[model samples]
Target chain A: MSEQFEMVPGNSLITKTPEEGRQLAVKMARLVIKATQPDSAIREKLRPIYSEDAAMLISVGQVVATEFATIAAANNYWR
Target chain B: MSEQFEMVPGNSLITKTPEEGRQLAVKMARLVIKATQPDSAIREKLRPIYSEDAAMLISVGQVVATEFATIAAANNYWR
Candidate 1:
């Protein structure tokens, strides 16, 4: 609950201490997952718009998944 | 001229109309250029920390440069 966790413009949540950054990255991962899920309505809308970069889109999805897993391991959030 | 140009997280300036997005992208490009210039102190500080992803860093630099050029063309800012 540091103010640094607050997503503000020109403020990078990833530049904090590793632990804090991991926590914030987890939150962002959750948002990205929800937004990009294949069956999700938003994803359906975004698919055509971002069709040219499908690989990059998938890579970002994987990055979010991996980051969330790392956060879960560190915080024991899923244990 | 619009509030959307503000660089705030949870508020993507790139989602605006192409013209507005281009303008905001130029501003971001300027910041990135300043931050990543070779022989610059900040780039020296970042180089060691981001050694593993040197290509990605360079790609971001190119993206900013290209976006700035696009903005300049559309707005006739350079002409």
Candidate 2:
């Protein structure tokens, strides 16, 4: 696999900080949003990563989860 | 980064089959559910991968997306 561990959509790696995690999640969410849109072109581009309905559900869930983490960090929940 | 492309939770790689992708998404959702529980021990184990609230949001979203994908494949939407 010609790949390196660069943070992309749906990755399970933990970020160094809460902010980093949130940002990564947001990026992933964008992929879902695009793939779900009513257009084949978008799907074609993202199909490699999100080639099924299950991927869409996971994408939506992940974005929400990451947002939760980001807000917690912002509100000093971790403190 | 000491990693290989294998199927796991919250992963964005497109699986060869829809079933495989859904299974992966479900695995990630479980991670979020566990991390959100009122226990630090579980979080400690998953911290390296889901280390923040943002990650949790993403986790939840991703699981749903995969489910959707799986269902679609089952219904022959891709056909």
Instruction: Give the poorly placed runs of model 1, Cα more than 4 Å off.
Output: A1-37, A41-79, B1-5, B8-52
| DockQ (CA atoms), all models | 0.02, 0.07
Positional deviation of residue B7's Cα in model 2 after best superposition, in angstroms: 17
True contacts kept of 2: 0.11
lDDT of each: 0.40, 0.44
Model 1 residue B39 distance off true place after TM-score fit, in angstroms = 29
Docking class of 1: incorrect
Q: Candidates' TM-scores?
A: 0.26, 0.27
What lDDT would candidate 1 get against the real structure?
Answer: 0.40
Tens digit of per-residue lDDT, candidate 2, span B1-35:
21332334434535544334434444545445554
Tens digits of per-residue lDDT for model 1 on A1-79?
Answer: 2233333223444332333433354356545545446356766576444322323323333343345334334433321
The prediction achieving the highest DockQ against the true structure is 2
